[model samples]
Target chain A: DAGITQSPRHKVTETGTPVTLRCHQTENHRYMYWYRQDPGHGLRLIHYSYGVKDTDKGEVSDGYSVSRSKTEDFLLTLESATSSQTSVYFCAISESPGTSRYNEQFFGPGTRLTVL
Target chain B: AQTVTQSQPEMSVQEAETVTLSCTYDTSESDYYLFWYKQPPSRQMILVIRQEAYKQQNATENRFSVNFQKAAKSFSLKISDSQLGDAAMYFCDRTGNTPLVFGKGTRLSVIA
Candidate 1:
């Protein structure tokens, strides 16, 4: 929902190859986030962006990088993909948090990525 | 640091019955928020309910309600009059100044 879309809903990449996942939102929200979901791990934040050209690392930022060049787009890049990097990635968007309104993060459908 | 824990890995509930999923969290901060998110087979994360730490009253939404005990650091979701459509993976989450920390999740199966 929230007018969010992820490209290549399904992707397969070879280990050591570089890969990128794209997230786009039409709601013009100021906050965008990238998360990976795994069994027993729930969802772990990979990286998040607060505004255009502003980003920060998350709990699991070792193998992930993100960039927000525009208000609607956020990209997560894997400089060198590995089998351990394969997981279902979800993108979420939220308006200014700490406010009572629009604080909920609406998630995208998710992308299933596999690294061989 | 904030951490969420869902004790029940899986549970089953009969149609038209009620079921409760347990969640416990650890946080030192006094002000924060907790949320319940449902991920069905489609894998889309849907917000079910939210509870503010400062509020004593439990949060409710139709058939869904939460038993939030701030002192106990426990937040549990109760689904009454369950429907088959309610079957999904439910995740418990907490957030303060940082991003949300989620529990592993509880898989709920609604039996007909």
Candidate 2:
């Protein structure tokens, strides 16, 4: 198991409020990604970071923002939470293709957020 | 864009029996990767198996094996000696230069 952890394992916020979730990894992997899991959707990428201060949007980047100021930490923020944004958010880390060609991401436990 | 499809929403297998879950993907690129991930009741995502497009032989890990057909763009997972612990939601994913595209998932049940 990769040494990855997500903060605020569970959170609740009212609609129109701001919320943030944090992901930390001890492995010092170069790739970090944020995803969300909903009832009908298995998992959708929200954002990804290849390095500190470098980030890109994903398939479902609406209503979400992410920042990676450090190698070990990636933050996902919801400027104004909406009911549709309530879902289980997961953080993943992966190393670039090197000696081992299989580049699979290691996931954190995940953060369950609810918007009222 | 790549799209992964899991036709079976749910499936069941008796203890000790073997079962196969279906996954099909559409992509224009030949160099890519296919993956199967298991999410048990704990919601932990476990990498069951992965297949590299360049590899002709199917990828196998213990009881988990994948039947990958490049022509048909199909990748199916076969589980042998099914145990209750094997029961979980299975997701099929595909990736190349882009982020992973996942199927909705198939709920697997193992009956004693």
Candidate 3:
């Protein structure tokens, strides 16, 4: 798991509720990413942070917001959860992008969110 | 935008046999990276192999190898001596200046 941990491994929430998932890393990597996995879709990046307070949106960034106040922690917030937002979320960390020799992303176990 | 395509949605192979998973991508960048990641029932993403667009030689790791055709915009993974543990969901992805764009994924089943 590359010293990465995601809180709330499983959560069942109702629609219109607010949900926040936390990702913590001990590796102190410079990059952190939030991705969602669903049927028919392998993994789609929701958001990523290159450095503290430097975050960017991904292809599927709508309805999702991210914050990285610290290097080790990256948080994903669903302002108002919806049924479509129910999926398995994964957190990944990497020392750098493709330029680094250790460019591979290390993923956490994952957090399963179910919205009714 | 970079897009990865995995043509096969599902494939099955007998134990000790060999199987090839096909993946193709559309990228305009000359310098990029391609990767194959595996996710078993545990749901943990594991890196199987990677290929640099600048490298002409294929990348191999033990029984796992890749056939990278930079000009053809194709990268395929070849697994030799398949085992039960090899059964999993495999995703193909490419990265350039932005985050990795992944394929829909292919499910592999290994039968003994």
Candidate 4:
């Protein structure tokens, strides 16, 4: 179990409405990531941040946007919710990618989001 | 881009028995990392095992072990003395310098 927490463990929003999910970490890790899990898709990265204000798009980042203003918090926002975006979202933290200490990422419990 | 493939969509094993889950990946990078993750009904992702490409010896953690064949581009997970807690969706992943690429996943059912 990591010291990571996602706010609004379960959310249901209507279509075309704005939605935001928050990921907060107490480990002070350097890297944080947002991932979405679906039935067929194991887990797809939506966005990642190396440091505060530094973020990169992942394989599926079309409808999602992210912001990391501080080391402990990362936010994922959907401007307009869609049915396709309904899935379980997970937050991960790692100290370093190449280093042995942080080679493996620690995942949060996850947040289930539903859109109608 | 790197890709991970889990051939078996589902597997079953009796309690106290051993079961193996197959995984294969495609990548051009010589040095990388491979991992097996387990997600239970609670939807919490847990790390089962990890294997470094440079290490010839397979990695093991308690009852979980990996059979990594670098030349064959295959990394399989073996669970010994399976328990009810072992029943879950297992995912195989690979990563170099980029983000991890995961397979579709294999659901394991532990039958008593």
Candidate 5:
């Protein structure tokens, strides 16, 4: 455990409803990312933040939004949940990209989200 | 676009046996990084090993080592003396300026 916790470890929501998943870290890492895993797709980056209030979209950013108000917390929100959004979501953090260490991503326990 | 391909969808190896999982990636960038991540049933992602594209020597970590063939665009992981704990989904990944691009993953079964 990297002192990372994801709220609502398991979430079940119906289509057209709003849902939010939270990720909290105790390490004060500067970089945070949200990824979703599905069969045959491996893991796809949904969104990532390099600093507070600064975020970027990843390969699969559509249908998902993210916010990082503080270094310790990053939130992923689905404005209107859809069945296509059902998957296991994972949160990862790493040292800033240029600080010498690369490819060292620490992951959270993961959240299983199901959309009906 | 960068893509990673893990040919083996499922593989089984007996305890104390050696097994190799194949991974091939396609990228135009000459300088990048390759990685192997393990996900047990627990669903936590663990780093197994990593290889810098510029490095010719294969990276090794205890019981886990990689056979990195840069010319062939292949990076395979070999686990020696397999243990039951080795059973899990192994994912091959690539990273550069963008986030990592992961392969579909190979489910490895360690039979006792």
Candidate 6:
């Protein structure tokens, strides 16, 4: 499929442990984002990258970290996992041309992370 | 900051019938985009339809269409001849330089 794939569809980790979620895209998009979804808060952005090695934080970047060392892969790391970090994480990519509105985002199946 | 709102938490429609899900948003930027995403039990976020802010024409994809009221800052989704496959959580989103801001989502139930 010409889409994005997220590793470890489901994971359970202990508190204070370091966990990393990987997002790989075959579409070669310029923009990649990490978002977490909870029950009533909809989906909140954690981090996003405009290009390779160019990234910025979103509204919810407190305990999360992200890296976009290459164009095809974006990794999100939980420095120290907390129970509050337990949520469904999603990776999205957009192929917006120069104007940055050329295409909509494509999301992966999402990784269900449970912090114990 | 932009915010998307889906007032109806849940909705139900009979098969072959029509149903509309309401979405409201607040954005100061005039040039942006709106989208509807569907997440089924499989947990895959699928793009149902999209609308460019500058365009006046409504976007339609198969049985899915959008009634976009830009002046009102309201965008609602209409499903014509709803099917069982339409049962999923539908989310309205607004996008700009920032990542897409999504609504809480409305879970739709298709009764056959």
Models 1 onward score TM values of 0.97, 0.97, 0.98, 0.97, 0.96, 0.97
TM-score of the second chain for every model: 0.98, 0.98, 0.98, 0.98, 0.98, 0.98
* Model 4 C-alpha lDDT per residue in residues B8-70, reported as the tens digit of each score: 999999999999999999998877889999999988899889899999999999999999999
Worst 10 residues of 4 chain A by lDDT: A95-104
Stretch of 10 with least lDDT, candidate 2 chain B: B93-102
lDDT by residue for model 6 (A1-116), tens: 44899998999999999999999999989989899999988888899998999999998999999899899999999999999999999999988832255668889889999999
Candidate 6 per-residue C-alpha lDDT over B1-112 given as tens digits, one digit per residue, 9 for 90 to 100: 5789999999999999999999999998878899999999998888899998889999999999999999999999999999999999999999875668899999999999
Q: Per-residue lDDT tens digits of candidate 5, residues B6-62?
A: 999999999999999999999887778888999999999999998988899999999
Instruction: Judge the docking of candidate 4 as incorrect, acceptable, medium or high.
Output: medium
Which candidate would rank higher by DockQ, 5 or 6?
5
lDDT of 2 by residue, B1-112 (tens): 6789999999999999999999999998867888999999898899999899989999999999999999999999999999999999999998778877889999999999
TM-score of every candidate's chain A: 0.96, 0.95, 0.97, 0.95, 0.95, 0.94
Please rank every candidate by DockQ, starting with the best.
3, 4, 1, 5, 6, 2
DockQ of each: 0.67, 0.51, 0.78, 0.68, 0.60, 0.58
Better of 2 and 3 by TM-score: 3
TM-score for candidate 5, residues paired by index:
0.96
Q: Mind sharing the TM-score for model 6?
A: 0.97
lDDT by residue for model 3 over B20-62, one digit each (tens)? 9999999888878899999999999999998888899999999
What is the Cα-based lDDT of residue A103 in candidate 2?
75
- Per-prediction tally of clashes: 0, 0, 0, 0, 0, 0
Q: Where in model 3 is the C-alpha error above 4 Å?
A: none
Interface RMSD of each: 1.6, 3.1, 1.0, 1.5, 2.2, 2.4
User: Can you tell me which runs of candidate 6 are displaced by over 4 Å?
Assistant: A97-99
2 or 5, greater by DockQ:
5
Q: Which window of ten consecutive residues has the lowest lDDT sum in model 1 chain B?
A: B93-102
Best by lDDT: 3
Number of the top TM-score candidate? 3
- lDDT of each residue in A1-116, candidate 3, tens digit only: 48999999999999999999999999999999999999998899999999999999998999999999999999999999999999999999999886556778999999999999
